[model samples]
Target: IPKTPLWKRCVQYTDILGKRLLKKIRLQYLQDNLEQRRTARSSNLLSLCRPTISLDPIL
Candidate 1:
């Protein structure tokens, strides 16, 4: 039955928007970390599979 003031509503909206943005940023950071780990693991595996050979003509 009572209407809220415009400034109060704006403050509430800004709070909600800030929380949502923080959540999105956190999720993106986690995803980037996961991807980095995955790539590092794959690179390790590839290095393990490939053998290093010397280019010198001496046997």
Candidate 2:
């Protein structure tokens, strides 16, 4: 039987590497978005509590 060509190996490696890079970029974007949301929630909670704490002393 005949052997396979070397060009096929290069094509396969290129496709695999491209997919792996895309997956990594997508994961990083998701993590950054989650961190932003968490920060916003904490700041909102702090602002909501400020008014109640300030008014409790007079009432």
Candidate 3:
């Protein structure tokens, strides 16, 4: 059996941490985008169901 060098261990640890961080960030971004799309879709449906009236003196 052989022991790994200290620098190699550190590099491996950093790589793992960076990957986990990136995964978390990507997941969060996707969730936020999905939420935004859902809200936009709901608002569009609501607007379509309601009639818009313009209040103008000339009209």
Question: What is the descending TM-score order?
Answer: 3, 1, 2
Report the C-alpha lDDT of model 1 over 1-59, residue by residue, as the tens digit: 12533333344456466766656655766787778886884556545656775466886
Q: Tens digit of lDDT per residue, candidate 2, span 4-39? A: 333333344555656666566557657866788868
| Segments of candidate 1 deviating more than 4 angstroms | 1-17, 41-59
TM per candidate comes to: 0.40, 0.40, 0.41
Clashing pairs in 3: none
**How close to the true structure is residue 41 of candidate 2, measured as C-alpha lDDT?**
45
TM-score of 1: 0.40
Model 2 CA RMSD to the hidden true structure, in angstroms: 14.5
Poorest 10 consecutive residues by lDDT, candidate 1? 1-10
Q: Candidate 2 at residue 56, lDDT?
A: 45
Model 2 residue 10 lDDT score? 38
lDDT per prediction? 0.58, 0.56, 0.58
Better of 2 and 3 by lDDT: 3
Candidate 2 segments whose C-alpha is farther than 4 A from its true place: 1-17, 41-59
Provide the RMSD of all predictions against the true structure, rounded to 1 decimal.
13.8, 14.5, 13.6
